[model samples]
Target: MKEGIYYDCINDFLNKNRDIETKKLLLVAEYTNFELKKLESYSGEIIGAVVPFIVYNNEFFNKGIISCDLEEENNFLLIENLKEFSIEDSFFKKSKSLVVLVDGLSSYISDFLDNLFQNIPENTQVIGGGAGKMTFERDPVIFTKNQFCKDSAIIISLNKKLNLGIQNGWEYLEGPFLTTNSEKNILKTLNFKNAFEVYKQVVEKDSGKKFTDDNFFDIAKSYPLGIIKYDKEVIVRDPIFVDSDNNMVLVGDIPQNSTINILKGKEDNLIKSSGIATKKAMEQIDLNNENYCVVVFDCISRAIFLGDRFVEELEEMKKNINPSKNLFGALTLGEIANNGDEYITFYNKTCVTGILC
Candidate 1:
């Protein structure tokens, strides 16, 4: 794979790469300050976020583009409906190994991912994220070389080897509380009481912090809900908004009847965990004289919670991986990683690192 970064303008990147030949191209465009239409091109699919900055080749660019070239034609797949979609046998006939990148609506992430993993081959490795915003105003926009889409998703398939690592540095605060009532991504009640009331009460008690509608996100971001899995693996759900009825809306899904816990994290530990996650990912891949790029899917909530110290977290990840390796990705509303596990989970307030060679 070959990677290039352009910072002057999207036009510069598009004009220069018009003649390049490759099996597949992945574009990570940052739209923090500019509009998405400005970067629209007539070449490859673009999957990314309206993040504050972009990370490419272990460096930062406020508004830039990172493009990569792969060497296989049938290696890319773009799907709309996970359940109805089927991979052509011929696509994977040449190479069974695959890397999947997902950019979907925050509210429908869990349902999309659940159906996605069920239909894909068992050996397929996946790593991607919920591509949208925390604002909840306009739905996140995804584009494909020509048109922009909303409330939809894009799936990219690559025939490269990848090593994935997922980690959320949150510790349990309370509850094996049952999700008694819920809709897709909204928690109506927990253990027979209003979900927000239970959450607010526990957070106020644990941190001695008061909860008000105005400051709910500021206080709640440090504390997210964890869906308990086997061997104590918890899939985190970040509560983004609370309704008038105090029903909490999470970034990912919380199915009815599932047991959950409120989790807490300190800045120091969260930063440390990034390094550990990078190390864990490195352990899964063979790094012997091969060129690889590290793609990160980090939760935007972590940036809000860490404030200026978020730079330290990124630095920690760089420290763990080889200094010469390239790093690039977006700060997503939620992260996705299957890593050959029993389930492909959609997570919030976590960091997922993928070593692709």
Candidate 2:
């Protein structure tokens, strides 16, 4: 592995540890809605340098995964062949790790993930899941400027010594325990009611807030969903969408047959959870040496809830992580982490922090 941070306009930061040319890099960036062209233009340069597996965007304007090559020469083929390319086809063989970028409508992510990991190598590590949807476009190298166009994702594969660790903590409320009647990645029903409705009921009853599409965030953002693991151990994930029809709310995938409970959160608790996540990641690694990178998948709800105080958590992570290491991450619709078992767990309403050294 090569050592040192390579920062550029197109490449925000790259920590190469070894002289591995065939580096497996997993890169992800989220941009505002409908800005795929601008986002892709810059991402094209980033992945072109590292040879990414596939780039993804979560703007679920349609029904399938859009596919394309990084090079302009294959632009026509990539878009035209998108339907033919399953999410698996975008990932080539010899992939050592994965880099991902996401923003825009995050609802489609779970749909992509259920299929994406099917053929991935068992040992592969994930590197990126950076913040937000960008609407405006800037140079591939420069990351300044904000535009809300479309949500997108980019993935890269790396080959070399790589490590990743994730930590998250969610407070589970005693009430709001509900059964999952039907589900998919972004859509689900709880107690035969739409996710939004159930949420409305809870908030109106407790907080006296009305549930409406416009006021969904007033009650729904960072809402927690509890899951029953195989051993009956419980974990919570957050919901990302509220489908009006079928009375089901859309969320990242919740394994079938798992019991779900809706949990509530406060701003202070969310920040504390971030600290806990950082500590957990640190606990996973040796921590005897300087780290290379730390990627955070904080729920956007946390950011919206915390506002200015959010940077405190970032600084805390920077201090806890060796100052020599680089840290970057995004507020995502859903976060994925390994639970020290065969499964790479997906979470919502929790800070999913991953450190790579």
Q: Whose TM-score is greatest here?
A: 1
lDDT of 2 by residue, 128-194 (tens): 3423322212123112123221233445544433444443444565444455555545434555555
Tell me each candidate's TM-score.
Answer: 0.88, 0.65
Off by over 4 Å in 1: 1-8, 21-53, 57-62, 81-106
Model 1 residue 24 lDDT? 39
Runs in model 2 with CA error above 4 Å? 1-44, 48-96, 102-108, 127-153, 160-165, 174-180, 186-188, 193-195, 231-237, 240-248, 255-257, 286-288, 339-341
Cα-lDDT of candidate 1: 0.71
**What is candidate 1's lDDT per residue for 1-357, written digit by digit as tens?**
344343455666667767554443444445534455754543454443344345664455555665656654545666654445555555554443444444444455666667666666667778777656456555545555555555556666666667888888989889889999999888999999999889988999988999875898999888999998767788899887787777898877788999999999999989888878888888877758467778887887887899888888899898888877667777776787876645787888998888876
Top model by lDDT, which number? Answer: 1
lDDT of each: 0.71, 0.45
| Pairs of colliding residues, candidate 1 | none
Candidate 1 weakest lDDT stretch, 10 residues: 23-32
